[model samples]
Target chain A: MLETHDTKLTEDSVRQLVREEIQRAFKKDPAKKQACIISSKGTLDWAYPPLILATAAAATGMDVSVFFTFYGLNVIHKDFERKLKVSPVGNPGMPMPVPMPDIVSSLPGMTSMATTMMKSKFANKHVASIRELLDVARESEVKLIACQMTMDVFGYTQDDFIDGVEFGGAAAFLSEARKSHLTLFI
Target chain B: MPDIKEDVVLDARNLLCPMPVVKAGKQIRTLEDGQILKILATDRGSIADFPAWADDTGNELLEWHEEDGTFVFFVRKVEEED
Candidate 1:
């Protein structure tokens, strides 16, 4: 009877150990839940991807960070609304109301016209604007990091950026990227 | 349609990709465990996005259906244990 009891106790302990091991395997480490993104373009159309992905990741309960370098700094700039514009010159993919030659698209004021058209089209489609996306990103606590080297090259001061922006270098971005399984360069 | 009582109603109509899920995520934070959130979105992407978002956030997606052009989702909040 004692041997049988000892055997039952051993079996119960083994089962308990297996259950704990299974739970440990299934439980995701909260610290590793992160997303890192690099936004490299400044154009109005190019700005959406990073912000959209960052906000979505944050909504899914993951920490998100967006590294803005080069022209991508315009996304965090205070004058982003005025600075971000879409240019039709040398861009054949852009759907135009009327097909125009490259020369016409290259003419002065074409960029502004293209920018306006794109903005209106997005608005009509109920797509979130850059301003709205930034608001959501900020509210969701998605880290927006501006590359210090790019800011210096572009003659942008720390004061030129919008609120909640952190100044960082490539190393800072790499450190964050290393910890995240999802990293994208856009 | 089976009546599912919701603790909150979020109108994310006409919002594009990410907005519906983003807003729904924000709205769901206000609810307690097991409280239901009803989301009305016009974005076609929500059909796929909501399920993915629910699964990612550890929330329960009770049911989803389409009415006219709107996609309706009912999700139950599952509070995470630290």
Candidate 2:
């Protein structure tokens, strides 16, 4: 096939390309405005994802909702400061800043120690704390929905959760999730 | 490059990832269409974060540069029509 160099390099064509680039840059779809998250894990480390993502999404003007199920209820529980702690004993491959025997990780109060260390590390890195993220979620009006089935199974009353936390079931979560363009499970 | 004059300037220095973006989102709302906002952030991540945020919000990221270890971003408000 013979090459044809018929296309001329016009200044207006170049300007049109730049204009299209800016227009494309400013295009935001309506679907990306909504986000739904399922927080099904209760570990201290696991808690970060849902809260961090929801708050960040909400900050970006997305209508964000988080549904907490099963053990994830601890995140919205009033006593999360005491109830939420990470244990390193069961996981042999858990990363620790220092090399330590598994025996040390299994000792009593080690979970709390690990939690304290993780909290400090996050603080030093200027990352928002779980509580601070929750506050941001609330301030940003991110919907925090607690699973009703889990509440009933665990015998937790509505008062067990913090203020502004809504009660909902799987159906309710799905209803919100379906409308959201971004759905995540953490 | 010519200095792009801004209508509003936000100092988001020393803030983390989402904080800067969140603050910028809120600030941009107060601006009218075609208005430009200048954000000064210390977080290196804002280099990418601002453009991503501007794209998500239907705003214009005119230009961004680094000065004295600070990431300065100029974002023009472009309201998304319903």
Candidate 3:
């Protein structure tokens, strides 16, 4: 609040200015600075969003939490190299090194080849690798929550995940999502 | 162009979308409110990405320009009430 030497200034106008300032302040509420993302798909192509968004959001000072469930467990799994293979079969839109038919994409070693090609393409495009993004997310303090029920169903123990992974369930995720203004399922 | 100074500079050239913005965001936090962060990136997509990121993070996008093939942006950190 500053002094207004103008004789035209009114008391009601001063109150209005304060109200507007409060509204502007509320625009940056802490709740709005929260992001809760759910990772449900495990494939290499599908793995990027949750990690990328979580890391990106955290970089901007938002409190971020990523709940990994179902096949998404592959993202935090120790064998991510083998677990995060992109299947070329039935994915006609996926660009290929050579124009190959669907049958060729389904042949043995195709998934591994496709994953390798994708890794190289992403690297060439200067996109951060998934592992790098994961590291960034962790460094930025974005919570990595793995679903306990899914782990049990898939016969995965806590030791199967990388360090700093938290085990939780649907309620845990909802608790965070309910408090966050930004929620995503990817 | 008019003279505009920056508090810090980040070279994000060769880094793609999200990475440039992410690095800028991380660096901006180390600055005080109203301090400017200058970024250099080669990703054409950063033309749209930086402004959107600044808006999302409640920071002020002072200005942007291109130098040769690089996209340059200046952002001011907005200190939110915690």
Best DockQ goes to which candidate?
1
Cα lDDT for residue B22, candidate 1: 94
Q: Which of the CAPRI classes, incorrect, acceptable, medium or high, describes model 2?
A: medium
Ranking by TM-score: 1, 3, 2
Candidate 3 structure quality by residue, lDDT tens digits, A1-186? 456625666889878888988978767566778999999999999999888888878877789999999999999998887889898899989987789899878899998888998999998887898888888888889999999999999999999998889999999999989989899998
Tens-digit lDDT track for model 1 on A23-115? 676566554579999999999999999999999999998999999999999999999999999999888999999998899999999999999
* Candidate 2 lDDT, A46-157, residue by residue in tens: 8989997887788677999999999999999999888788888886676788876879888888888888888888788787778888888898899999999999999999
TM-score-better candidate, 1 vs 3: 1
By TM-score, the best candidate is 1
Ranking by DockQ: 1, 3, 2
Clashing pairs in 1: none
lDDT over C-alpha atoms for residue A86 of model 1: 98
Query: How far is A97's C-alpha from truth in model 1 (Å)?
Result: 1.0
Could you tell me every candidate's TM-score relative to the true structure? Answer: 0.90, 0.84, 0.88
Q: Show the lowest summed lDDT stretch of 10 residues, model 1 chain A.
A: A1-10
**Model 2 error, position A169 (Å):** 0.5
Question: In terms of lDDT, which candidate is strongest?
Answer: 1
